[model samples]
Target: MSQGIEAADDLAPEIRQFHEAINSGYAAHPPQPGQTMADRRQVAERVRAPWAAGGPAMARTDELRVGPRGVRIRIHRPVLDRGLPSLLYIHGGGWMLFSLDTHDRLMREYAARAGIAVIGVDYSLSPEAKFPTALEEIVSVIDWLRQDGAGAGLDPSRIAIAGDSAGANMAVAANLLLRRQAKPLLDGMLLNYGAFDHAVTPSHQRYGGDGYMLNSAEMVVFWDAYLRGPADYEDPLAVPLRADLQGLPPAFLAIAGCDILADGNLSMAAALRAAGVPVVANLYEGASHSFLEAVSISPLADRALTESATWLARRLGRTCG
Candidate 1:
C-alpha cells in the first residue's frame, strides 16, 4: 500500500482498496482544465464501470419511461412473482454524476438478497436540471408507482425508498414532500451516509481529507452545482436536515463512522428519533463515504448490505431469502 492508503488507518482494507481503485482511475484520466460537465461525466462513468460489473443475477430486468418528465426507470426483480414489495432506489453522485448503469450491481444485490424488486431511477442531473427538478421527477416516479406499479408486478402500498449520499437526501426530502401533500408516504427509508446538511461538522475536519471517497470541498462544489443559489441553503426540501423529520417512515441508516458526513447522519438519526420515528442506525466504524460500493470485496460492506437488506425486507413487509 502507498503512504496515502496506509495513512488512512481508519479505513478497512477493502475500503482502502476501493479508494485506491477510484484514485487510480481518476489519476489515469486526470481532469483537463476547462473540461465540460459532459467530459467530467464521461470520466466518472469510465472510473466507476468496473465496480458495477458482475453481481447476483436477476430473474428479470425491465426498463420503462415513467411520469410526465419521461424519467427512465430500471426494475430488477429477483424472482418472477406478482405483487412483490419493491424498493425505489436512487443513486448517489452528489445529485450530478452517477446513473442507473453505475449502480446496477448494487441494486441487483439488494433485490437478490432481500427477495424484493429494486427500481432504480435515472433522474435528471444538476447544473442543467437544477434543484427541485430532480426532486420533482422523483416525486413523479413515486406517484407513478402508486397508480401503475401493479402493472410492473409491484405492490405499490408496500414500497420503500432508498439511496446513498445525495440520493439519500432526496429520499427523505421526497417523504417530506409526501407528508406536506397529505399523501400516503412510503413504507420506509434506507439512507446510507447521506449529505443531509451543508453544515461543516467536526467529522468534516477529521475525515474530509483526499483519501476519503468524498471530501468537504467536493461537497461544497456538489451542493453549489445542485442548488440554484443561496436561497436553496434555507430550503428544507433542499437541505433535509433543516426540515421537521416528524411523520417520516421508519429509517435504517447505514452510517459510515469515518465519513465526513458522519456527524450530519448522526444528527439526522437523532432528529428522527426525537420526532418519534422508528430508526435503526448501524454505524460502520472505519468506513468511508461510498464504502458500500466495495461490497464485491469488503466483508464490512457485505455485512452492512445484508443487515440493510434484512431491515428493508422487514420494513417492506417481506422476509429476506
Candidate 2:
C-alpha cells in the first residue's frame, strides 16, 4: 500500500479504493490550467462516475420559467402511478459547476429509491450570480410550485429540498428564508456532507490537504467564487450556521466519514436538535466527500441514500415501496 492510502487507514478499504481510483485518473490525465473555475470544471469532467449510470428509466422533462430570467428545471417522476411527494433537488458543483444534465442519473436514482417526483433545480451558478441570486431563484421555484405545480405530477403540499456540498448549503439557507417570508414551507431538508459554515473545522485541518475527493483548499476557492465579498460570509443566506436554527425544516444530514465538512454537518445536526428540530444524522463510516456520486458502486452510498429516502418518505407522509 502506498503511503497516502496507508495514511487513510481509518477509511474503509472500498473508500480507500475510491480515492485511489481518483488519484489514478489524475495521474493518467493530470489537471492543466486548474487554477480557474472553468479550468477546474473541465478537469473534473474527466473523472468518470460509473455509479451514476444505469438508473431506472428517466421520466419526461419540461422546461419552464419560474422567474423572469428564463430559469429552467428538469422534473423526474418516480415509477409510481399516483401523484407523489416532490423533492426539489439542487445539484452540487461548489456553486460554480454541474447542471441538471450532469446530475440527472443521480436524481433519477433518488426518485426511484424514495418513490417521489424529483425536481432538479437549475439555479444560477456562482462568481457570476453570487449569494442572493441562487437563493432568490430557489424562492421563485418554490413559489411557483405552491401556486401552480404546473402539472409537474407532484403533491404540492408535500415537498422537500435536498442537495450535496454547496447545494446543501443553499437548501439550509433557503429553508430559513422561505419560512420567514411565509412564501412556502419546505417539509424537510436532505443535506449530504454540507459545508454549513465558512470557518474551518478539525476535519478541514486534518483531511483538507489531499486523498479526499474534496479538499479544503478547493472549497476555499469555491467559497471565494460563491461569495462576493468578506461580508457575505457573515450573511445568514450564505453562512447558515451563523443563523438562528429555530423553525427550520427537519433535516437528514448524510455525513461522509472522511470529508472536511463532517464536523460542520455534525454541528448543524446538533444545533437543529437544540433548536427542537427533528434531525437524522448518519455518518457513512470511511466514505469520502461526494461518495454518493458513486452510488452505483458504493454500498455505503446506496445505504445512505436509501435511509435518507426512508426518513424523508415518512416525514412527507409517503411510503417508499
Candidate 3:
C-alpha cells in the first residue's frame, strides 16, 4: 500500500559497498543444507563480526541479569556519573537471529554520542519462544529498569526504548502494553527501519531481493517463525500498525529508503503524528536495511547515527555537549 520511488542507483555508494562486504562474508560461508538454528547463528556471527568491532569505548561496562526471567543485559555507561539517563536498546534480528554482541558497537556509539547509559537486552528468540514471549521479556526489562535502575546508576524516569527491525517492533509493542496497563511509559522511542505491519507493499516488490539485504521471502519465514498462527495477524502487539497509537511518547524513526520495510516505517510515523505524539521521521535516501551497522564506512550511516543520538539526548533531557 506504499508508494514506490524511482532512482538510478538503488543504494548509495557507501551502502552498496557495505552490502558487498556482508554478501561476500555470506558467500565465503555458504549455508549447508538442513542447517540448524545454532549453525545459522554461527554463520551470522562470523559474517557480522567485522562490522561490530572497534567503536567508542565506555567509561563503565557491566553485564547483569534483570527481570524475573533474568534476561541478560549489557550496560554501557559513557561516564561513571550516577543517575544518568538510559536507553533500553533491543537488538534486531527478526526475533530469531543475532545477539547483544552483534550490536555492541552500535550501543557503545549511542552511549558515547548521547552521553547516556545504553542497556542492551538479550531477549528470548522465536519459533522456540514465539510471539508475546519476547514482548513480555522486554516489558519485564522495562519494569525492572523503572523499579531498580537507580541502584544500577540510571535515572529510570528518563528512560527511552530503541531498536531496529523486529526489536523496534517489540519496543513499540512493549510501550503500548505499558500505556494500556496504566504503567509509567518510556520517555521516547528510537526506531530504525522498523517492521510495523506484515502487509506486503510496492516497496517490498521492488527492493526485496539479494542486493537489498532483506527480501520478501525471508520476511515470510521470519514472520512464520515469530507468530503462532493466523490469529496473530490481527494482534496489535504482534503487528503494531494495528494498535491504537495514542498516548505513546515522542518518537524518532530512522527510515531506510531502499529497504523492504520502508513503507511500513513511513506508515508508523504517520500514525504516531495522527495520534498527536511528537514524531521525527528521517528517511535516508539510497540506504538499505541495517545500514547503521556500516557506520565505520558509510557517511550516510554516520550521519544517521549522529542525528539519532542528538534526538535521543533532546528527548531524554540530556545536553549533547
**What lDDT score belongs to each candidate, Candidate 1 first?**
0.90, 0.79, 0.89
**lDDT score, residue 15, model 2?**
69
On TM-score, the candidate that comes out on top is 1
Task: Name the candidate that leads on lDDT.
Answer: 1
Q: What CA RMSD would candidate 3 show?
A: 3.2
Give per-residue CA lDDT, model 2, range 1-321, as digits (tens). Answer: 011433276777666777677677556655565377666555555554443557778555556676565578887876645567788898887898877766777788778777788888889888888888998898788877876774656677888999988889989988888867876569999998887897888988877775677777778888998999989989888999888988888899999888889999999999999999999999888888877776666788778878998988888876774
Candidate 2 lDDT score relative to the true structure: 0.79
Can you list the residue pairs that collide in candidate 3?
none
| Candidate 1 Cα outliers beyond 4 Å, as residue runs | 1-7
Q: Is candidate 1 or candidate 2 better by TM-score?
A: 1
User: How many collisions per candidate?
Assistant: 0, 0, 0
Summarize candidate 1's per-residue lDDT along 69-145 as a digit string, tens digits.
89999999999989999899999998889899889999999999899999999999998999999988999999999
TM-score of 3: 0.96
Give me the runs in candidate 2 sitting further than 4 Å from their true place: 1-7, 27-29, 33-36, 80-82
lDDT of 2 at 140: 82
